[model samples]
Target: MFAEEFVVVDATSPLWNAARPFLDIALRIEQQDDSYLWHGWNKASIDAFLQKLPPHCSLMLGVWQVDAAQEQETLWLGCICEVVDGAVCSLRTFVALEDSRLPAIAQLEPGYIHAQELIRVTKGQVAPVAWALFTDKTTWDEWLLAADADGQPTDKGEALAALARQGRCVLLGSQVTHHPHHH
Candidate 1:
């Protein structure tokens, strides 16, 4: 899990091509509801965001099917990482592309909430989500239901995370047929 890991993005970086697929969806979604993503997703914001960004943060281009996505709706996200209050985090800025930019797709399913939380995370933790330039604004991070000694979620978001971690399920007491305790 620890070798050498870092994402480099700028005007010259190939990550610019990553935006093409999600362009239409984010555009329509943003227009239908201004609350989803502002500015959409494009090169200008990426350039400006990069120009004003610090060395400690990063811009993560990832395929995400989070809670906001409806049934199997996956969107490519241009996540801008920045520093605030002495800690590195996501800026929460949304960039709306003009009419020609976008990204691709994938799915994580809707009924299962575990995949939503665990997919983007590594070792049960992910970078604080940010997209906007930050001077003082803040957003909260999320946690799972059960935890292990290694600090990873043992059981949560349904049984997905827990079953994958321990590989076996142990039921106890008399209530629902399925419970979280597994070993």
Candidate 2:
């Protein structure tokens, strides 16, 4: 069975107010998938339910089953919402490694690579579909470069300005019309 969780970084909430909506979705999804599969659920569902969920709620769908390790580390399926310019997109993924480096199967999986490339190409944006996994202090800087490369920003200066104006902005998951300062 698959386990699911909904995480929201509401503009009005203090806990995750600094977080981007898409990032919250990604984390919640990862956590739910991790917890659910540990309890022995083979199948999971989210798409149909998510379709009807409020824009403020971010969903994560995960599936896994017990394996020879007897620790339930084997994950069979995972997916998260990718947001670009306020649009929601889906990315199918699987975990190849966890802990330490926290690297995932997407690194070696050709299908995931192809899907990411397709998203980059089709979206006309430079941001990676899986950027949240690489988040840290430099995330904003990296995102500025990627957005500039993707043509989302006209130049470094403009990107910097936008970042300054928006702080840490996220495009996917829930809908946030006004920036934190705006309210």
Per-candidate TM-scores read 0.21, 0.22
Candidate 1 ranges with C-alpha deviation above 4 Å: 1-54, 59-63, 66-71, 76-78, 84-86, 93-100, 104-146, 149-183
Candidate with best lDDT: 2
Model 1 superposed RMSD (Cα): 17.2
lDDT of 2 at 183: 27
lDDT of 1 by residue, 1-183 (tens): 001222222433233354443334433542453233222333333334345534343233333334444533333343333343323333221232111222222332222232223222311233332321111011101121223455332233244334324532221111124445555
Worst 10 residues of 1 by lDDT: 132-141
lDDT agreement with native, every candidate: 0.30, 0.33
Best by TM-score: 2
Per-residue alpha-carbon lDDT of model 2 for 1-183, expressed as tens digits?
Answer: 122332222233221223344344544554564333211211133333334444322222232222456633333333344433333443323221123333443332223343333333323322233221211234343542343223221343234345545543322222223446542
